[model samples]
Every structure is written in C-alpha cells, then in structure tokens.
Target: MPLSDIVRALNAPATGKRPDFLYRSGLDHPFVAAEGRVFIHYANIRLESKFLPVVDTRSGRTHGHASTIQAFGLSNSVPMSPDAVFVLPTDAEEFVYLDRLVRTLHALNYLTQPVRGNLLLRVHSRHIISVPANHGLAFEEILRPCGLLPEQITLEINTDAVADKEHFIRAVASYRSRGYGIAISHFGRTELDFPFLSQLRPDIVKLDNLLLASGRPLDRIIDNIHELGGRILIEGIDSANLRRNASSLAIDLVQAHAPILRPSGIRIRRNADGGEQLDAAA
Candidate 1:
C-alpha cells in the first residue's frame, strides 16, 4: 500500500479509541500519523575562512583568500514547529556551533516563536578537550536563555564518555542543579559500573539497541530501573516481534522507524504475559 493509505488506515477510528497514529518510520524513530508532526535529524557542519596566502591540500596551491569546510554526521533530532527548530548537538564543539546557529536563526526571524518543547542534545566524551566538568555548565548557558524549561530539555551523554565515577557524578549534579534533565544514552551497552549512575539519578536512560535486539529477558532490568526512578527508552526496534518482546518487558518507550509505511497499523496491546506491546496491527 502507499504511504498515504497506510497513514490513513492507521488513523482510522477503528484502531482503538486512543491515538493510533504512532508509528515507526526509518530506524527507531517514532512519528505521529501526520507528517507535519514528525521530527527530522540534522548534522553539524563548520566552515572556515582565512584571508592569507596558504597552500590548499586539494588544489596544491596558495591563494589570497581560502576557505575550509569540516563536517561531521553527528546525529541530532529536531521537531517541526512554527518557531525555529531547536537542535541538540552530539558534542561540545557541535553544541557551540548549534548555539550560534540558533541565535542567528532566531534573529533572522527564520524561526517562528514561541518555541516548542526543549530540544535534547547529545554530548560525546571526545568533544571535551580538557575540563569535562564544565561541559554541563556550558550547556546550561547556551540553552537557558532560549526559553526552554529545565525539565523540558535534556542533555544526552553516552555511558562510555562518563567513565570516571567522580566526573560523571559531578557533571550530572551540575546539570540537575541547573534544573536540566540529564540522560544516559545507550545504557547497557557494556558491563560498565553503574553504581554511580543509579546514585546520581539521571532522569532518563536510553536502553542500548543491543539488548532490544538480543530478545533477552528484560523484565528484571526494566523493573529495577523503574524502581530506581529512571525512565527507560528502548531503541532499534524494527519488527513486530521485537516490539512484542519489548512490550512484554514493559519498556517505558520503544523507538521504531521501520514498518510505518507498511500496511500494518500501530498496535498498543498487551502480550500473553500481560506486558505492553507496540507493533504493527495484524
């Protein structure tokens, strides 16, 4: 069936009284029934311009004016809104660039106001050049003035980047002090020590795709995290089977990007084990 037909069918009233438009599109990204409500992923790019006679690597020559471009496919998500879309960066440098871009976009009136929900930005460990401790403070400075609520915005940090117990705790504490939500992305990727993670008490924890793909027993893990007062988001779920499995585990959230365009509709039901399920309707 065509994409429009699939969306139309999914939105039909028969698919349960509650909202039926929730569907997975490309990977683990969720999308509403309407296209306008979907979020887009963007990468950061840097352009350098210098007025000097310098050798060009590509042209193998010198010139009075030269420009260099550096770009990385750092993943970030931004929801569509009347105002300018606020994007979160994957690293400190990207965050810097994003801060400038957001200001420019806002000043130019290219983005409409009032702004929507706070954008969640990812921070990679490699982005910290020296004082990793200052990263959270820097992020708060960049976002607080943008009219984003502390709880509405989240800073996503990979578990690997926070290898140091003391540093991780401090960083999380600093952000929490600023009223910003701290999230640990890609949780359960490795057997890293999580004693501090539980202690620091981040608001969100994104479960690793590995665990979702493995189809392992996750009830205990989910229950434990919930008990610790952390919201869990499961990623990389691409099939009904995986969705069923995740729902059975009672994962707080499941991201699916595939099968949305398919004929099947989003099914929010319960598995035989009495756990929640998110998959295409049979």
Candidate 2:
C-alpha cells in the first residue's frame, strides 16, 4: 500500500474495517506500525514467511534485497530504500573472502534490473587502503560487470577506525577518480572534522543512528552538509519506533531491520545446519 493510501484510510470515516498492506516482501500485513501511536488497522492478515524485510520509507515498497548471512537466518538487518551493507575483512587472512564477496555482489544477475537501486557494500577504512592498488576495480571496472553505473553502487568506507589517514584519503580519491560513489560511514561519531569532509567530498554521508536515536540534535552539522548538497543516510534503525523517528528526519536514505527485497524472487534461506530450505512464503 502507498503511504498516501494509509493516510487516506487513517482519515476516512469509520468504515467497516481497515485496509491491509501487501508488502514487497510478499508478506501481507494489517498495517504499518508507528511508535506508541495508533495501530493503523488493515483488513486482511495472513501469515507469510518472514525474513529481514527492507522497507523504503520514501516509497512504500522494497527497493533492495539482503540477508544477514552471519546471523543464522535470524537477522534483523534491514536494507532500506537505498542499498548499504557493512563489509569488513576479519583479518589480513580473510581479504580474499572480502574480495570474492565484492566480485560476487557485482556479478549478481539481479543487478540487471532496469531501475537498478543502490547496491551498497560497505568496508572499513583499513580494507579501503589495503586493496592492492592494481587489483581493485577502476571506476568503470566496478560498473562493467554489474551493469550498474558508478552512481548506483556505493563503496561505503567506515572511517570510525581508520589506522592511517593519508592512505585512506589516497584510496578514497583513487576510487573517486574511477567514478565509484563514495560513502563516508559513521559520520557523527568519528573524525567529525569539517575540513576532512570538505577535502574528502564524500558522495554520501551516513550518520550514526545511535546519536540520532538518542535524540541529540546534530542538526547544526547535518544541515551544513545538506546545504553543501551532501546526501545523508541514517543507519542503526533497529526497531519500528526507531524507523518512525527516522522518517521524521530529512536524511536521504535509511538502513533498518525490516525486509527490503527478496533477491531474484528466491526465498531459500540458509538454515543453522548450513542447508537451504524453500521459505514457506515462497
């Protein structure tokens, strides 16, 4: 259901019952939840298979699909309207896996979707600097296989624990030159240096949700970036209530625990035993 429909139903006269929503995840629900507010009613309620659903707050639909592979089919990780995902090399030894993961994400057949959304794959600053200069994809190289343009796929780098600033800037600039969209992750908490932001000129600034959720206003800084035409993404939206609050903000995007997309319409989830089963909803 569209947000406008919900608004209409909310204001409409006392009808027999309320309107239900068919989520992009294929799950049918009564209504969208708000924090401590009215439980907007919906007519049909059916128990469909449940997964981490990503809800695009901007549009009432799923924009991207993701799974919490690390959480044993129990992920609350949401991939919202804009795509963003956290990637980190466990150690120097796991760099291969990280690289492979990036390559695999780029090669996904679903990337061929006509209106390809942001397929964000995040990584730490150390990994950004560590990418063997010759091995990492050039700007167009990143777009070639995926068929997603430079702007579609975001190379999110968390600066929270950068070990080396000079190397980090170099790596970021290298990617920038190549046309890969740059995302500076954990904006409010780490670095918080205006000059660094000015120099880096990140394509996206992902703010820390902890502070946003705490209700501590970072409006002064956030507004400054907005003025400069920087896109803001709010993460750490872990619950329904949190999402309501996020909607109130002017952030460009959001990451939540809700199910966003069910990639390629395949619902075979990885079980704890390391086996895949067809989701009942499927």
Candidate 3:
C-alpha cells in the first residue's frame, strides 16, 4: 500500500475510546505499545551492550498487556489489527516505508535515552534496508537521518528464519562496519546451529535454557564466541537451578520471569549463583 494511503487509514477518526497501548503512527502499521519514555532494560551480564529491544520488543523481559481501542483508528470493529507486522524485502517501496518508520523511532529517541549499557537497541532488517547486499544505500540513509550513533543500536536476525547466507553475511558486515551490534536470537534445542558464526562473528549468541543438556556443545560454542570476542545469552530460564547451570557454563545473560523480576528476598549478586535482577543496576 502507498504510504499516504496507510497514513490516511490511520488518521481517520475513531468511534470509541482508544486503547492506551494502541498507537496509530499515521502509517499502515498499527501497533499496540506503551507510551512515553518506556524502555526495556537488558542486563549486560558478562558483556555490556545494554540497549536491545526486538521490534523494540523492550526491556528486561518485563512484558505487559495493552488492548486496542474498541472503535477507533484502523478497524471499525473487533480484533483490531494483527498484533505484529512483518515486512518483506519484496520491493524497494517496502524499505521506503520502513525507512520512515525507523527514522521516526530514532527521532523519538531524542525524547528518551535509547541506551542502557554498551549495546544498542535492537531493530529488524526488513525492507532490505538492513540487509547489505540488498540495502542499496538504505544503510547510508538510515543512521545519518535517524541521528543514531552506532553504539546505541543492535540489529537482530532471527536465527531460525535466515533464508540467504551470503547476502546475510554481507548484511552483518555492512552494519558492523558502521559499528552496529549484531545479535542472533530465538535459537532453540535443535542441532540446526549456525555454522557461519566464525564468519559472521555476531556480538551475541542466544540459546534457550530448555535446550541445555549434559553433552551439548555449549562449552565449545562459548569458547568459539569468546575467541571471537563475543558473548552468549541463555534464555527461557525458569528456575534457580537452570540459572545456576547457565551461570556455571558462563552464560553472559538471560531472560525469564525469575531473573528479570527482582525476587524479594534473594541477595542479588553477580557470583557463582544466578546473579541479582539485571534492572537493579539501571
């Protein structure tokens, strides 16, 4: 759809009370989100790139719920728009729309700090603007206009969804050249590991604690990342024991209800045990 059309669709007047989390960005994309200086903090753990939000998915795993307006904006009825919007590199125009979206978010950063530690806030590579071989100067256009320094952002690649290797590698390098942090996440228990890490050299590799095992090659992987000057994140940690084992293997960071939420009585420390709440420092 044309950008003007999307904006017009969103700009149309509402019929009822709008949901607090609902945002009509005057774009075709309708998103449900919190307003005003909201940030999701990622614990630096062993490493320090602190600002990373998936789709701006946000800080420290502190998830919340927001309902869409019953009668306003995009839809005249229920279900609102879909909860998520996926962009494809089908055409240059897609990137054109995305470019505007990201730049607007970058401008919003001026009203709020986008950094937490040494890391940058995570964003996606849709519209080919984030993909190097396909970017076609999109990269050049984004950072400069967004007024974002390389240090405050991390571009994310869904590990399970990668379709092209050569082009993706080039994409990683392209962003890396400009100082963007790269993180590969949503890694699962399967053995379909990324063999190109040695070549791509992502800043962080995330794995699920559910996939932790007696003979998994996690140690070897950790060693490889350490050699490359990168770090590992263990997600899906639900227990103290799981966190304990992850810490034993030297997992750099984690995301789970227990770790993210400050346990009332636990002494938060970065030690042999699973450390304190990450947001504690922030």
Candidate 4:
C-alpha cells in the first residue's frame, strides 16, 4: 500500500475509545507524511526517525539498522537531544504512551521499505519500570498493524541504572517470550557483571566506545559473552582506528557515528508543512 494511504488508514478514527493506558486523553493519530518519510507531532514536539546501520565486521555488510529519533521543539524549531523527551515530568501512563509512540513512529517509517535486517530499538528504562506486567505486549500490539513481527525487532535496554535486578530479569524474559530479541546497552566492564549477564542471557551486549578507549582488556568479557551465546556490539564508533579495533577484537556488530548521519534510503518530500522543518535529502 502507498504510504499516504497507510497514513490515512492509520489516522482513521476507531469505533470506540482507545484504552487509556495506550495514550493520553485527546490524543489521536500524530503521524504526518513528508517527502515520502514520516514525522510525528505531539504536544509542541516534533520527531523524525534516523536508522543507523549496525555493520557485520566479517562480511563488511550491514547486519541490521538501529532506529533513533531526532526531536525538535515545534514552537521554536530548535533541536532537542533525543534523551530530553524522556525527562519531562510526566506520569507513568503518559510516559509509557510517549515511549510507545516513538517506537511506533520508528516502526512505521522503517516498514515503509522492503529492507533487510532486524530493527534495533532503544527502550527507555523508565518505560520498562512503568509497566507492571507483560513487557512487550503493548509494543507488539502496536507493531501488528504495521505488519512487523516481534522477532524482527530487538529492544536495547540500558541496564546499569536498573535498581531492581529481579524486575529487570523478568522484563527481559517477558520480551524474549514474546519473540523479541534483547540487547543490554552500555554493559558493565567487570567480570562480576558477567555472571548476571550469563543468567540474563541477552542476545546482544553493547559496549560503550569509552570502554574500548579505556585500554582495559575486554578479552575475558568478550569470551564470557560468546560463551553465553550472545553477540557483541560496540556503539558510538567514531574513527577509522576504532573500526579497525572492532574487527580485530572479533566484535560482531558496530554502530558508527559518520554512517548514521547519512541517509538510509528514505526520502523526505520537499513540501513538508505544519511548521515541521525536514531535510529533503535521501
């Protein structure tokens, strides 16, 4: 189906009120089509999706694309860091609504093309904590209308700040049970974290670029992750040397800063309106 038609279909009013847990009061379809791409409008905020390629070192091919959103203030057109949106003083329900909205926006924009590889999505830790049960159920429902399967998505969660390890483990298990892949973002550097990681058994372990720069030996950590059947992804890779190190270290996935700035095959129409400024480059 055409993207315009899909937008129309998605925006059409439902026969009954949507569940309050899914959206705030008076919120409807927030999606807009621009230059063949999708942007979302919500409460004086505008969001656009960017897909960063996660390259496979061995084949030198993109193994998957990680979905990231760039946010801007709708009133002043000033850019806001992606993390700023989550810091608002919103209730749990509203936060869940906002978090799921962003993920849905990414999913819709990505599914518009017949692309290879799974979609890597970063889930706010607060969003995980807000839900009392059934972690992936709501997001899975959101993906259903877009023809996206839970197996096609990997949820990246930053686990370092999680105060409740038990809750975190259960949440990861719930997501996995629903066919979603799990990735522990910015994973710890020490061997102590490895036992819990082994217990959790995530599909991917993402290391911060700073960890590699620290000159600490990651050999044991890498071996432990591999032994537990998890792949390693190094995030925020910025230089040629870092890329070379990633290959030499047997890293399975790498996310670079430069390639993320380039367009990943989606074209925005030149005629975007509604005070939403968008780049027309593809």
Best by lDDT: 4
Task: List model 4 lDDT by residue over 117-183, tens digit each.
Answer: 8889988898888888899998887777677899999999888756888888899999999999999
lDDT of 2 by residue, 144-224 (tens): 433456555556677775567667777777777666667787777744666667767787787775656566776677787
Which of candidates 2 and 4 reaches a greater TM-score?
4
Whole-model alpha-carbon lDDT for candidate 3:
0.43
lDDT of each: 0.44, 0.48, 0.43, 0.76
Q: What's model 3's lDDT at 99?
A: 38
Query: Weakest 10 consecutive residues, lDDT, candidate 3?
Result: 40-49
What stretches of model 4 exceed 4 Å from their correct place?
A: 13-22, 189-192, 258-282
Clashing pairs in 2: 19-42, 52-259, 53-258, 53-259, 53-260, 54-258, 54-259, 54-260, 139-178
By summed lDDT, which 10 consecutive residues of candidate 2 come out lowest? 40-49
The estimated TM-scores of all candidates read 0.50, 0.55, 0.53, 0.86
- 1-282: candidate 1 lDDT, tens digit per residue: 333333343334454421222222221122122332212123332211111112222333321111111122233211122112224444555544444333222211211223323334455444433345555554444333333355655666776545566776776677788776776777777753467668778766777877656767777777777877887765433445655655455655543322221123354544334355577633
How many residue pairs clash in all the candidates, one count each? 6, 9, 11, 2
**TM-score winner between candidates 3 and 4:** 4
* Residue 169 shift from truth in candidate 3, angstroms: 1.0
Using lDDT as the measure, what is the rank order of every candidate, best first? Answer: 4, 2, 1, 3
Report the Cα lDDT for candidate 4. 0.76
